[model samples]
Target: MSLLLAAPILIPLTAAVLCVLAWRHRTLQRGISIAGAAGLLASAVALFQQVSASGPVASQMGNWPAPFGITLVADTLACIMLLINGFLAVCIVLFSLGGIGQRREAGGYHALVHGMLAAVSGAFVTGDIFNLYVWFEVMLMASFVLMTLGGQRGQLEGATKYVTLSLISSMLFLSGVGVLYAVTGTLNMADLAVKFAAVENSALAVSLGLLFFVSFGIKAAVFPMFFWLPASYQTPPPVIAALFAGLLSKVGIYAIIRTFTLIFSHEPQMVYTIMLAVSGLTMVIGVFGAAVQTEIRRILAFHSVSQIGYMLMGLAVTGAAVADGLPGGSVAAGASASASTSAVNAAIPEFAVMALAGTVLFLVHHAIVKTNLFLVGGIVLKLRGTTVLARLGDLYLTRPWLAVLFMVTAMSLAGVPVATGFWAKLVLVRAGLAGGEWIIVAAALGTGVLTLYSMTKIWSEAFWKVTPDAADLAAAGQHPTDEAIDAADIGPRGVPIMMTVVAVMAVATVALGVLAGPCYRVAERAARELLEPQAYIRAVLGPTAGRPASASEPAPAAASAGGVPSQR
Candidate 1:
């Protein structure tokens, strides 16, 4: 079972190698990509089941002991993430069949997509902080290339902004890692959790933790740090935009959740307060940003920032719950207060688990629904030649099914009933109320209303009232300027493969909404593992890894399917 931990990363990586080898043969590369995606999905299913049955598991490379070697660990959290990642891989690969043009395919786009997946999976499973950093670099390298592919003016501009922000994030992350190693002499997360309990320099330790928060904040595109996202994400083709929207920011968010719950709770009152402020502002600013955008992808880009704020809200609530419920409120305290502080370390507060579980659900729902929206946007671009709302008018008449699909995902995004987003928000809101976070809860509700308005903007302007074909675009648009929009330069093109892939994803969103119980259970279980890290520690280190940090020391505290881009 420990071997299955590596499958997610290895499968896509092998496929990427094969794709590069067959670069001269597009058909072979295509078949190889599809097969690889399918295989990853299969592996994810098996791994998820195994984790569910046996609890968390870890494997050390070269059979080295804990804190001494490379480690791959999979708890419920890792497996659930892998499951979603594999599912999105399959969807994005299939969509690329008709959505991407031959020129891009010949440019090793399949290879690049697989490479990106490999990096993402590596990030999900790695047991060391430094290993996580390496995966981030791998992801940056692949995504930067993907963004700049073909070197179009917009693509180059967007890639530049993307790389600029990403490099800064990398520097901050590396600097934090240096501080951590200098202080703790270890980089393994489980080991760090143990040692962090014993560190006496609360100020320096928290400063190190804050450093990571800022780094991940920048990466996650939280408010103030998020300006680059709409500017760049909108520049990619809708397919590429969808992939980034679904996965990249979520990884940043994932990092934030991981570090805060596991290694940064010593000063929770201060940390979570600052975080709550950031989350509230992120939601407000992101929704307003989307409201000002007329392009489909740009609007979605801004909303991505808004949705991320909600994830942080859940994190804040979870942090508060964990800190308050654990007697003495810090790992240092837990270490000194008990004879068997390991039991205290292993315990998870009920409230913290519920809140984080809600966060996990939101993360899953957001990835799928957001990716589905981007694919719908791509279909509109393929058929209409542009995403400008004023230039589009009659898609509802021309493609009723496309309109329905858009409504399905858009409704889900706005948290309408019978959609996964609705349930996710409900859980978060409930958790927030339980934790007495009334202000942030109010902010979240207001953001949902604004989110609906933004989605409505897209529906009314681009989808509800426009011609979907080249022949009628000139006569049907919102302005005489629409005549100058050049129908022939774009659409009325067929997107059967694209539509088919989208329909399947659409069904998935609805199914997730209707059958949300099993998912909720899985999410709650994952949250438990995160808050109670003893299982993870034991898995990576050994059966006795959960022993107290030292004879005199305190106890320790406990702890995306986004797609590839398409070219048209």
Candidate 2:
């Protein structure tokens, strides 16, 4: 079980080392990357099955006990994330074979890609908060190298901004961890949850929570903190951009969900209210930014920010459900009682589980669809030799089949019916309405309209419009076509690997919508585990770990706010 739990991280790290060793042999490197990605996907599936059958699983490194050793955990949430990461890594690596170009591969491209995958898997499973920091640093280092692999002017410029801001966020995260540790004296997340609740200084706890919020909010690309994303994401290769879009920000979202629900559940009202406001603003800003972008990748980058808002909306609504005493409220209130001496535990309303489930569903749907869109953008770049919208046209005329695939992903992203995104959005909207979060509800609906408009704009300019001839373009006084316009560009031999990968993702996007019920059930189960983490705590700590304190119970004397007692 421990080996299975560690497989996702170990496989990628091992693959990266092998790829680095075979740096002089491009074919060998590619084979190693592909095999490693396949292994990761298999491991993730097995881990998912194990978690489903055995409940939350945890492993302490070097046979050490909890709170004293490095711990890896595989709860439903982590398992779901790992599964998505595995799937994306496989598709993206395959696409890279045809799309990343030979020049880039010679510079250790496969190694960096696998390194990023390892860091991502490590982040998903690590149970210790400090170890999460280490994983984030690994991710930043690998991603920085990937972003600048080609050493192009634009790539260097983008890497500079990405790494600069990411480093700052990392410092903030580390500082927050230090403060949290100073207050609670434990780096283990499960232990922190138990220890933090016993601290007397509620103000200090909330302050530390805000620190984490800002650090992760920047990483998640929410609102004002998202400026760095659009600036840098469009500069990298399409596959790298796709990976960033699909997985990077989602990791931040995952962290937010985990930290808030498990460790910071003590102050639901304040934290969630802030999240609700930020979510609405993030949706508006992201769509508006996308509407103004002329480059294909830049537009997609902005849309990534917009979709994050929907995920945050679900998160805020879940928090609201806890505050309002909705379906899952008992779980939150119970978790809080176990951690602290708070008096606001009186039943106010029933917490709706749908809100949390909607967030998870949205995350899954967005990752697949977003990555497909970027891969499609890569195909466009291959066909037209440019990503500028004005320089591109007539894709639907020259390659109708490719147009079909683009429409599938675009419509899914725009939340069109019978696409996975539509169901994902529907659930969030329903949850918000149920929770009476009218502002966020309006924001979500409005964002969807803007999203559709942006998609249609791409369709019209890039596909519906004809590729104007040199004379027509000259007559219009526009800059001459950067690359000669040719129908041959869309021929089968252009990039079969990229096309195959996009097609697979497109089918998955549609299938997710068609099979929404089962997928949603899985998300619901994951959300339940988040709201009530007693099972998670016990799994990591031990069966002897008692049930979390009930909301109605008086605070235990040993748990007074002065400080955590010395009992281990």
TM-score of each: 0.92, 0.91
Give lDDT tens digits, candidate 1, residues 24-132: 9999999999999998889989988888998887776665555766778888888877888898899899887866656667788899999998888898888889999
On a 0 to 100 scale, what is the lDDT of residue 341 in model 1? 44
Candidate maximizing lDDT: 2
For model 2, residues 165-193, the per-residue Cα lDDT tens digits are: 89889999999999888876678887776
Reference-based lDDT, each prediction: 0.80, 0.83
Point out where model 2 deviates above 4 Å: 326-336, 339-351, 471-494, 546-568
Instruction: Please give the lDDT score at residue 308 for candidate 1.
Output: 93
